[model samples]
Target: MDVSDILASQISKHKSILVEKDVPLDTDVGFLTVTDPSVVDKESYDHDREAYLQSTARDGIQHLLAALFSLPTLPSPEGPLAQLPPPTTQLPRAKPLPKPKPPTKWQRFARAKGISSQRRDKKIWDDERQAWVPRWGWRGKNRDEETQWLHEVPANADADHDPSKEARVARKERTAKNERQRLQNVARAQQGRTTATATGTQVDRKRDINRTLATTRMSTASMGKFDRVLDGEKKLRGVKRKFDPIEKSVDAEKSANLALIKQIGNGAPGGSSLKKVKRDGLDSESGGNGGAGGVVNVRKAVRFASGGQGAAALARKSVVGSGSDGRQKRRGKR
Candidate 1:
């Protein structure tokens, strides 16, 4: 008993009302039809019939009326439409116009022969004459008064013209140029050969000098002088100087060792165990392993030397002999 119940009750009542109202048999024909059949007068009926005819006539002939009243309507043609004539209007024909007058005898001669003068055209305003005077010449304004330089064709010499003179001149110039170039090329080639032979001789001389230098041995006379100095130093009374080679070498070794120890100590903070092993390998190579390790060590030493002064200490201390103690440690003893 809520909104649905109310809606159902209203729909049921409206359905019955619609059923009764919609029955064809229950419809009132009397109310729909005119009550008096004679109520329409003859005038009214005729007027209504006339009005209907007028409305249909207006609706049906509206287009025809428009056509009849239209201005400038076109007429339809049969078969092919006649071709329209082309427009007569066209651009004006250009006139020959007036020709200008000549300036000098030479210019007139060149212009009459249809040759252009090297002189440029110049226009100047003449105050007295009230006209422009040109520097170079031109044809006159009046055709009849124009300078008559035109000539009639010669009867005898009109048949032949030859270009062999110009052709011969061009060929001569070309031949001269080619001959000059050929001479230059031959001179250049001769000079090049002489220079090459000179260079070869110089190179051969240098090679000979180097070979002689390499094969020649030092003289014992130089060593004999050094031995004399040593003997004199020993015999000198109370002038004993400690200039022993063995002592100098030992001192140098000790100094180098000290420098190496100093360098190792300075780099110890940043040094890795791997670097120590690499240094050991380098030592083995410098001692004359001469393998890949030797090459690597060479590169490393060069790089370290380039890096800073620390490499100087290491280089000074490093022994440059075969391995550490002059032994090829890996090979079996021979």
Candidate 2:
């Protein structure tokens, strides 16, 4: 018998899914996105809606697969994987480009003098120390004279003059001068940034001055409270506060109530306070298992009276059994 013809007929029934569009699908291989600009057939879509939707989806998938298979593939353990090319689309940045930092005072001076800035190593050779030492910090070559015990006094020096004290003062002054210049540079850069408009510049300058003044006031012995108050000075503000704790959990309250019920059931001390609990069973949750005079649970009492038959079956025995939706009626006739 020729069963090959039957098998061939079965196989030919499902041909490759063909995608036909007016403008063709815009395929981005990098992002694996396909945009179809063709208009849908409303008559075909409205009639046989489910089949139409399935056909449309099948077309899209067929087009995507065709595009993917066209690309070169690399061999993998599972199968050959297509290598996606770089994206051709340019995307905008999430945030605006940051402003460049303003040049420092020394940087500007160096530029004016046509001097290229060069960074030197932190450690330097010292003649007196006879070893590699820091250029300008603790025990540095610059501070050798300040730490030296012996000093050659000048020819016309005062009797009470101290060489060590003089060296220390000079070092401190140099450091203070450097710090002052650094602060001035920072202030100048800020001023340049804030000077977008004349009125805005004045407002920013005043705000900066007030902030500096406030800092000085807070640095006082009494924290500006006992210090002499200047006219029109605004009071300092602290973080918002409250007496009670935030985000109190309900679980603790539930546990407390359960414990109280259990305690009263056990007949604990201080009976007067728990008088209400003893009198009433509170609710069905109590199950009437509290105190000497406990009200029985209604459901349990009914079950016992009916000899193990549930409430519903016992109820149906007397009257005509009613349907859950109340559609059933008297069964006297039909």
* Candidate number with greatest TM-score: 2
In angstroms, what RMSD does candidate 2 have relative to the true structure? Answer: 26.9
Q: In model 2, what is the error at residue 246, expressed in angstroms? A: 80
Q: Least lDDT summed over 10 consecutive residues: which range in candidate 1?
A: 18-27
TM-score of each: 0.12, 0.34
lDDT of 1 by residue, 241-284 (tens): 88536556777889978988988876554578898787776766
lDDT of 2 at 302: 54
Q: How high is the CA lDDT of each candidate model?
A: 0.49, 0.75
- Please name the candidate that would achieve the greatest lDDT relative to the true structure: 2
Candidate 2 lDDT over residue span 1-334, tens digit each: 9999999999899895667777788777787777677788999999999999888777777898888888999999999999998765557879999989899999999999999989988999987668999988877788788778789999999999999889989989999999999999999998887667756868888989988977888998888889877799778875587654554579866787788998878766556766756445454224333332335555575566446876655556434545432211111111
Stretches > 4 Å off in candidate 1: 1-162, 196-334
